[model samples]
Target: MRTNSPETKKTARELRNDPVLSKEYTKNKIQFQNYYFKLGYQWSKPDLNSIVCRFAVLIQVIRIKREELTESFIEYDTRFLGGNFQIPDSKELLLLIFLNAPLYQVFTTLRKCSKRKEKYYKDRVGQRFEIQIGYE
Candidate 1:
């Protein structure tokens, strides 16, 4: 799924945000994939990664491991280092571990983005997902 790992060491924002921080790479630290770090932080979101990593192992899934979360499996099984994912899905739910969203914000980013019509939702504390179809 990720072929770009070997060619480029860091993501666009990492290079753009600060040229100086890249020097840390020279220290030979464990290398994580570009996609799975914290927003605005060149660091890995371990809690987030742990959720995916653990679940994957529990379900016996994934190419990367929980400890390293490396970019890829190197020749002779060396492994690159860290590998979190930057994709939208990774940021979501335990249903937020998968959705990266609160129940309300899944439809819209704003918590209060949608307001139910008073006529339809006046006193319905609990409602089903079904939408009513008007009579022809």
Candidate 2:
């Protein structure tokens, strides 16, 4: 797993120093809310990662254990989006986490994951993956 713990370490320092990052974060939050208001697929929202992290924190505040967060996500997904995903659905969760996680934490986690992937195989950076549908 990528290490996002570094982000947690810098949270106080970043909050104290950078007004720009803070403004960007606040702007993203509003964009996320507007996306939800439009009734777009929840996946289309921009600040999904932050939302996920927020939910994790919320669960803790509600006296739920961190160990139960995955199960809670499953429950929340089923209730809001119809059913639990067959595979781990981190795309949406990542978006929420990114938004909710401290900026430094998000970047660190992404960097670690990228490095780990590179260690296993040569990656084609900028390669595009697409899907095409044929209708009869």
The residue-by-residue lDDT of candidate 2 on 8-101, one tens digit each, is 6578578757866554332111112121211223564555333333211111101123334565454443332333424232332221222122
- Model 2 accuracy (lDDT, Cα): 0.29
Q: Give the TM-score of candidate 2.
A: 0.20
How many pairs of residues in model 2 come into backbone collision? 12
Q: What digit string (tens of lDDT, one per residue) describes model 1 on residues 41-122? A: 2234435323221111011112222333223422212212254223223221111011222232111010111133222222
Residue 1 in model 2: shift from native, Å?
A: 48
Overall local distance difference test of candidate 1: 0.25
How far off is residue 50 in model 2, in Å? 19
Instruction: Quote model 1's TM-score.
Output: 0.13
Model 1: residue 56 alpha-carbon error in angstroms = 27
TM-score of each: 0.13, 0.20
Local error of candidate 1 at 47, Å?
A: 32
